[model samples]
Target: MAQSRKKAVKKSFDPQEVLDFLRQDELDYPAGAKKFGKDAIPFLSDLIEGTDENLSMKAAYLVGYIDDESVGDVLKKAAEKGSSTIRIAAAYGAQKRSPEVAEAILSRSLEDNNPSVVKFAMKSVSSMKLGKKLKSKIDHISKNFLDDDIKNSAKDLIKKIK
Candidate 1:
């Protein structure tokens, strides 16, 4: 009975375990997040949609680590419609996925109003072999963006794309 109970607790919610694991000083959120794998999505999504600033941001990034098919669409939506904070996290999270999978989020983030989002998105896309559409957008950004850092990043991307 004890073995079955342990299995149930591990598979299900052991509230105390979550508190203990997440509260650790060196809390490896990615590792802890994968504990529940895809099952943690609804809870993490709630936290991202919640009003708490820090928690929302953390949850937003954690969603990227979920090994599930649904995570991509979820990240894309957040990258597109979420607040600047979530957008930034989405950019960061998108980097965890394949370049092809992450391309759209990175491209949109490069066009974001938030400089931080644009900056981080540039960093994410920097290593990817950008497609023509994205290269053209980068060229435009290089020519039009006011921030030298972002403009420089766009210019760099243009060189690589060519």
Candidate 2:
């Protein structure tokens, strides 16, 4: 008797399907849906570039969880133009996937109009190796940000960097 062999078929990329899969609350980093990083890149990229703010933010965060290095461009773009929530997520993702770009993105985020974005940017910056230029920029933010909370946070980061 001859056995029939089955060929595996690759599924087409579907943003909605990937979004649905990612929407589950139990997904954890280094396991779960994060293991599908390579498969989810295209869908997550579309969502990051989409106009829906909430979905875009969700997608940005998912990019961070995903292990693919190709996520750098999408994360940088989202960090530059996406809403504060998306910027925070993208900054984090970029920090992990593309440290060089993350420095610029996080530095630019320090000037974001939203204090929350600046706060998260400060958090990301703290994880990086602080050099003279970045330390100077952090000093400027600590002295100039309009929000006292952000200023204090920047000041605290400065102390940590020192």
Candidate 3:
């Protein structure tokens, strides 16, 4: 009986069930965020070009957590792709991963010509705790982007740069 029981033990997880679950939306973004981690670099690179701007942006945001250099490229592209929400999220994501990418985003955002994007970009940069390196970049943009409002906002970030 014990031998029969051992041989008859059923699998707890069915492969087909796993595939069906993976097809759900809730299982996609944040779940993808947790599972892919650094291994998502290649998948994100492709997702950036997807027709769904929201998905592209979501993928971009998650890609930043990958802690890989390629995430910078994807984030930069997302910021330039006209999905304001995605750009802001990617900017913040990049801020946590790469200072250079964050700086590039701030440069565009500081002088963005789009008030909303500039506002979001300023907010994102202000949240960065990147020390002197980010401070110097902020100073440069503050002086150069100098649109009064954007300059003042960047100054606020400079004060927080400690």
Better of 2 and 3 by TM-score: 2
Ranking by lDDT: 1, 2, 3
Candidate 2 C-alpha lDDT tens digits along 1-162: 122221121244455666676676654645533545567777777887788777777778877766666777677677778678888887666557556767767777766778888777777777765334478777988899899988888788888777
Q: Over the stretch 1-162, how does candidate 3's per-residue lDDT look in tens digits?
A: 987764443333233443344345664544555555555566665666677675666666667666667677777776777567776766667566556777776555545555456667666666665435556656765687637786777777777775
TM-score of 3: 0.60
Which digits, one per residue and each the tens of the lDDT, describe model 1 over residues 1-162?
999977775687544565455445565767866776666677767777777666666667778877776777777877887678888988888878877678878878877877788877777776555545577667878899888888987787788777
TM per candidate: 0.80, 0.79, 0.60
Clash count in backbone of candidate 2 = 0
Identify the candidate with maximal TM-score: 1
Clash pairs detected, candidate 1: none
In lDDT terms, which candidate is top?
A: 1
Error of model 1, residue 34, in angstroms: 2.1
Per the 3 Å backbone cut-off, how many clashing residue pairs does candidate 3 have? 0
With candidate 3 superimposed using the best TM-score fit, by how many Å does residue 53's alpha carbon deviate from the native? 2.0
Global lDDT of each candidate: 0.74, 0.70, 0.62
